[model samples]
Target: MIVVQEQDFDLQHEYAALRQDCPSIGAIVTFVGLMRDFNDGDNVKSLFLEHYAGMTENVLADIVEKAKSRWNLQAVRIIHRVGNLLPSDQIVFVGVSSAHRGDAFSACEFIMDFLKTQAPFWKREQTEQGGRWVDARRSDEDSAQRWEK
Candidate 1:
């Protein structure tokens, strides 16, 4: 499942939906990203996220497909929120279900790594100084690269 919206999601609801009717699923792993209060030495008041609609969903679906090709996954769910958001608000969710903990854990991490580097979303942070467009971090690239090797 791939969801891109402006409203907040219920984590438990999503998890349940992923595991539903999958009696073979013995493990489920979920990752939720949240907006922070500070970033790059600035005290962030809020965050504004924008995406290219159809293009964003297509990329996310591709990321999920890659995860499925690499793991024995039973289900996968991804949800990313857009528009203005405040600190501590949920930003994204990645959930993976499988018959074993290892697959669930690895696939969950892999999906998030790809999502961070591959997704076409622009972010701007609001601070006391002004709103600034956030840059892609080298750490994020490194994290995604580890999966290639």
Candidate 2:
């Protein structure tokens, strides 16, 4: 599942729902990304996120499909929030369920790594210093690169 919305989500509820056993699911991996209050010594006040409506959802769905193709995952869920958000708010989430722990771990990481670079969302941060556009980190690129065939 790929959902891009401005609403906040409940991680515990989502995790419980995702972990409901079909008996075969042995592992579930989840990642929750939160907006931080500080960036490079500057105090971040808020973030303004922008994304293309249909296009962003399509790309995210494609990423999830790619992860499913690579792993024997039972379920995958991705939620990304858009619009204005404050520091310490939930920014995104990725969850993967599989019959094995290894596949669950790898696929969950793969989805988040791919989303960092491939997803079409841009963030502008409000800081005490001023507003600035956020850039994709080199570390994220490196993380995604390691998974590419």
Candidate 3:
């Protein structure tokens, strides 16, 4: 499952929904990204995220499909929030369930890695100096590259 929305999500609700009625799933791994108070040496007041709607969903689905193909995952869920957000706000969530811990862990990490680079979401950070478009971090690219064949 993939969701791109402007509203905040309930982590507990999402986790419950992901594992609902799935007795075969032995392990579940989840990752939640939060907005920070500072970035790029500035005090960030808020963040505005924009996406290309359909394009963003397609890319996210592709990332999930890749994880599925690589692992024996029973389920996967990705939720990314857009629009104005404040510090400590949850920005994204990725969850995976599998028959084993290893599969669940690997798939969950893989999805987040790919999502960071492949998802078409642009971020603008509002700071004391004013708002500026955020740039892709080299660390993010490196993280994604490690999973490449």
Candidate 4:
């Protein structure tokens, strides 16, 4: 599943949905990304997010497909929210289910690594100084690169 929306999601609800009817799944792993109050030494008040609509979803779907191709995943879910958000708010979710913990853990991490570097989302953080456009971090790129063929 791939979702890009403005509404907050219920983590438990999503987890249940992933588990439903998938009796073969012996392990499930999930990750939720939260909006933080500080970034790069700046105290952030809020954030505004934007995306390229259809292109964003397409990219996310490609990421999910890649994870499935690499692992014996039973289920996968990814949700990313856009628009204005406050600190501590949920920003993204990634879940993976499989027959074993190793595949579940690795696939969940792989999906997130690609999501951070491949997704077409833009962010601007509100700070005391002013709103500033956030750029992709080199650290994120490094994390994503470890999975390259």
How would the candidate models be sorted by lDDT, starting from the highest? 4, 1, 3, 2
Q: Write the per-residue lDDT of candidate 1 for residues 1-149, one digit (tens) a residue.
A: 89999999998899899889878999999999999999999899999999999999999999999999999999999999999999999999999999999999999998988899999999999999999999999999999999999
Cα lDDT tens digits for candidate 3, 15-125: 997797889999989999999999978899999999999999999999988898999998899999999999999999999989999999999988888889889999999
lDDT accuracy of residue 140 in candidate 1: 95
What is the C-alpha lDDT profile of model 2 across 29-144, one tens digit per residue? 99999999988788999999999999998988988898889889999888999999998899998988899999999999988998899888999999988899999999999999
Candidate 1 local distance difference test against the native: 0.95
Model 4's TM-score against the true structure: 0.98
TM-score of each: 0.98, 0.95, 0.98, 0.98
Which pairs in model 2 have colliding backbones?
none
**Model 3 segments more than 4 A misplaced:** none
The C-alpha RMSD in Å for every predicted model, in order, reads: 0.7, 1.1, 0.7, 0.7
Q: Point out the higher-scoring one by TM-score: 2 or 4.
A: 4
Looking at model 3, the pairs that clash are: none
lDDT of 4 by residue, 1-149 (tens): 89999999999999998897777999999999999999999899999999999999999999999999999999999999999999999999999989999999999999999999999999999999999999999999999999985
Runs in model 1 lying further than 4 Å from the true structure:
none
Root-mean-square deviation of candidate 2: 1.1
- Window of ten residues with lowest summed lDDT in model 4: 16-25
Stretches > 4 Å off in candidate 4:
none
